[model samples]
Target: MTGLLIGAIIISFSSVMVRLANVPPDVAGFYRLFVGGLGMGLFLWRMGKLKHFTLHIWAWALLSALFFVGDFFYWHRAIGLVGPGMATMLANFQVIVLAVVSVLILRERPTAAFMLAIPMALAGLYLMVGVSWADFTPDYRVGVVYGLLTALFYALYLLSLKFSLSKAGADPLAMACAVALLTGVLLGGLSLGQGESFAIPDVRSLLALATLALICHAVGWFLITRSVQMVRTSLVGLILLLQPTLSFVWDILFFDKPVNGLEIAGVILALVGIYLGSLKGKRGK
Candidate 1:
C-alpha cells in the first residue's frame, strides 16, 4: 500500500514534467518510453530474465503498444491545450469507459453504485465545461475531445495489457518494457514525419524529461505493478485515484490554472464517480 501510494504520487508529477519539457507531444512521448524502456530492460537483464519472453508475449505487447501510442498522442496534446489539471481529470474518464465496455462486450452486469455513477460523472463534466462550452475557444473544445479520446485509447491499452498479463509465464516487467520500446519507436517515427525535433532544449528540460522517464514511467509503474496485487481491489481503486487528484492540485499550484467554484465541485463529483465506477460488486452465491 505504501508503494502504491508513493507510486501514485510520483506519477502525479508526469503532467508537470511534460509541461516543463515543453517539447512537441510526440517528442516527449518518445523519450519517455525509450528511456523508461531502456531502464526496465537493464533491470530485467540484471535479473537474468531479459531473454525469456515468448513470441505470444511479444505479439500482445505489440498490440498494447499500438493502443498506448494513441493514448499518449491524445493525452499529451490535451495536456498542452486544457492545462494539466482538467486534462488529467478528463483522461481518467477511462474508468467510466471501462465500466461501459465490461457491461456491453463482456456481458457483465454493473452494480447499482456503478449505474448511479454514470450520470453523476456526466453531470460533473457538464458542470466543468458544458455550462459555457460555446464560449470557449475552438482549440479548447478540441482539447476536450482529445482528452476523451485519450480515455478511450487508455481503456483499450488497459484491456490489451490485462490480456497480455493473463498469458502463461508472462513477465509483467518484460511486457512493459516491450510495449514501451515499441511505442517509442512508433512515436519517434511519427515525430519525424511531423517534423518535430529530437533534441533536448536545455538542461532543465532534459532533467524534467529524464525524471519523467525514470521516475514516473519506470519506478512509479514498477511500484504499482508490484504492490497492486497485494492490496485489496477496492482499496487499490481508491489509492490509484491519487494520481489524477494530485495532478489537478499540481496544475493549480505549478501552472496557476484558473478555477471557479463550479469547476471545483465538478472535479469532486467526477472523482467520486470514477471511484465508484472502479469498484466491483460481489457475485451472487
Candidate 2:
C-alpha cells in the first residue's frame, strides 16, 4: 500500500515535468525515455542480469516498445493541449478500450457491470468536455482527440507488455531494459524526423527531464510493479485511482488551473465507472 502511494505520487509529477521542459512533446518523451533507459540499463548490467535478454523476449519487447512510444507521444501532446488533469483523466479510458479489444479479439464477453460503466464513463466525458462545446476551440477538440488516441495506444502497450511478459522467461529485468531502450530509440527517431532540437535549451529543462526519467519513469514504475506483487489486486486497482486524481490536484496547485463543479462531478463519475469496469473485468477473468 505504501509502495502504491509512493508510486502514484511520483507519477503524478510526470505531466508537471513534461510541461516544465518547454520542448516539443516528442522531444520531451524521447529524452525522458532515453535517460531512463540508460540508467536502468546500467543498473541491470551491474546486477549481472544484462545478458539475459533472449531472442523471444527481445521480439516481444520491441513490439511493446512501439506501442509505448505511440502512447507517450499522444499523451504528451494531450497534456500540452488540454492541461495535465484532463489529459490524465482521459487517458484512463484505456480500460474501456482494453475491454473492447478483449471482446473482439479474445472473445471475452463484457459483464453487466462493464455495460453499465460504459454509459457512466461517457457521461463523465460529456461533462468534462462536451459541456464546453459552446466555447470549444479547434485546439481543444484536437486535444480531446489526442487524449482518446493516447488511451488507444496505451491499451495496445498494455496488451503488448502482457505478451512480452509471457515470453520473458526468468529475466524480467532484461525484458524491461530492452523495451525501454527500444522505446527511447523509436521516440528519438521520431523527434529527429519532426525536426525538434534534442539539445536542452537551459539547465532548468535538463533538470525537469532528468527528474521525469529517473524519478517518474524508473523509480515510480518500479514501485508500482513491486507493489503489485505485495498487495491485493483489487486494492492495487483502487490505489491507482489516486494517480489521476492527484494529477488533477497537481495541475491546480502548480499550474493555477481552475476547476468547476461539473468537472469535479465528472471526476467522481469517471472514477466510479472505472472502478466498476475493472471489477467486472476481474470477475470475467
Candidate 3:
C-alpha cells in the first residue's frame, strides 16, 4: 500500500513535467531513461551491491526499458496528437491490457463487478475522447493508435519487470541501477537513430525534466518495485488503477483543464470499476 501510494504520487507529476518540457517528445524520453538510470546508479553506489548484478539481469532490464522507453516516446507523441487528459488515460489503459494478459497467461477471470464496470469506464473514457475528437481535427486519430500501443507495451513491461525483479531477488537498488544503465544505453541508441537534437534544454524545461526523472521516473519506479515485492500481481493492477486517476486530477489542478460532465462520469465509472476489481483482493487479504 505504501509503495502503491508513492507510485501514485510520483506519477501524478509526470504529465505536468511533460507539459512543461519544451523538448521534443523523443528527446524527453531519452532523458527519462538515461537520467532515471543515473538515479539508480546513485542508489547502487550507496548500497554497495553493484557487483552482484549480472549481465543476465541486464538483459531483462534492457528488455523492460525498451518497452517503457518506447511507450514514453509514443505516449508523449500521442499527447501532441490528442489532448493530455484522454491521451494519458488511454495510454494507461495498460491495466486493462494486463487483465487480458492475465486471463490468457495466468488463467484468471475478473469478478462480476469488475466486468460490469469495465465497459462503463471504457465508455466514459470513450465519451470523453469522442467529445474531444468532435472538436479536434480528424488527423488526431493517429495518436489514438499510438496510445493503444503504449498500453499494450506498458502492460508487458509491468509483467516482465516484476518477473525480472523477483528473479533478481530483494536487491532492488542493484536491480534499479543495472536496469537504469541498460535502459539508458538503449534509449541513447534510440535517440541517435531518431536524429534527435542534443541541444541543452532551457532552464525551465531542464529543471522540470530533471525533477520528473527524479520524482516521476526514479522514485516512481522504486516505489512500484516495492509494491511488486509486497503484493500479488493481481492487486498490482488494482494499485496501478490510481495512476490514471492521479493523471486526471493533476491535469485539472496544474494544467488549468476543466472536466466536462461526462468526463466526471467517466471518472466515477472508472473508480467503480477499480473498486470492483479490488474487491477480490480485499477479500483475500
Give the Cα lDDT of each candidate. 0.90, 0.83, 0.70
Report how far residue 210 has shifted in candidate 3, in Å.
0.9
For model 2, which pairs clash? none
TM-score, cand. 3 vs. native: 0.84
Ten-residue region with minimum lDDT total, candidate 1: 276-285
Best by TM-score: 1
Question: Candidates sorted by TM-score, descending order?
Answer: 1, 2, 3
Q: Where is model 3 poorest over a 10-residue stretch in terms of lDDT?
A: 276-285
Tens-digit lDDT track of model 1 for 1-285: 999999999999998899999899999999999998888788788889877677877788898999999999999999999988888999999999988888777777778978888998998889888887988899999999999999999999999998878863588888988899999999999999999999999999999999999999988887888789899988999999999999999999999998999988899899989998888754433
lDDT of 3 by residue, 1-285 (tens): 787777876876776787788777777776776787788666666767677677777766776777776677778887766656556777776766665555556766656765765686577657666656766566577887777788777777778777887775636666666666666666667778988885756899888888878778888877787576688755676677777777777777877776779778876665555445444322221
Better structure of 1 and 3 per TM-score: 1
Top lDDT prediction, candidate number: 1
True-structure RMSD, every candidate: 1.5, 2.0, 3.5
- Candidate 2 structure quality by residue, lDDT tens digits, 50-163: 667667777878988999998999999999999998899999888777777766678777777778877898898888888987787899889999998998998899898887
lDDT, residue 175, model 3 = 63
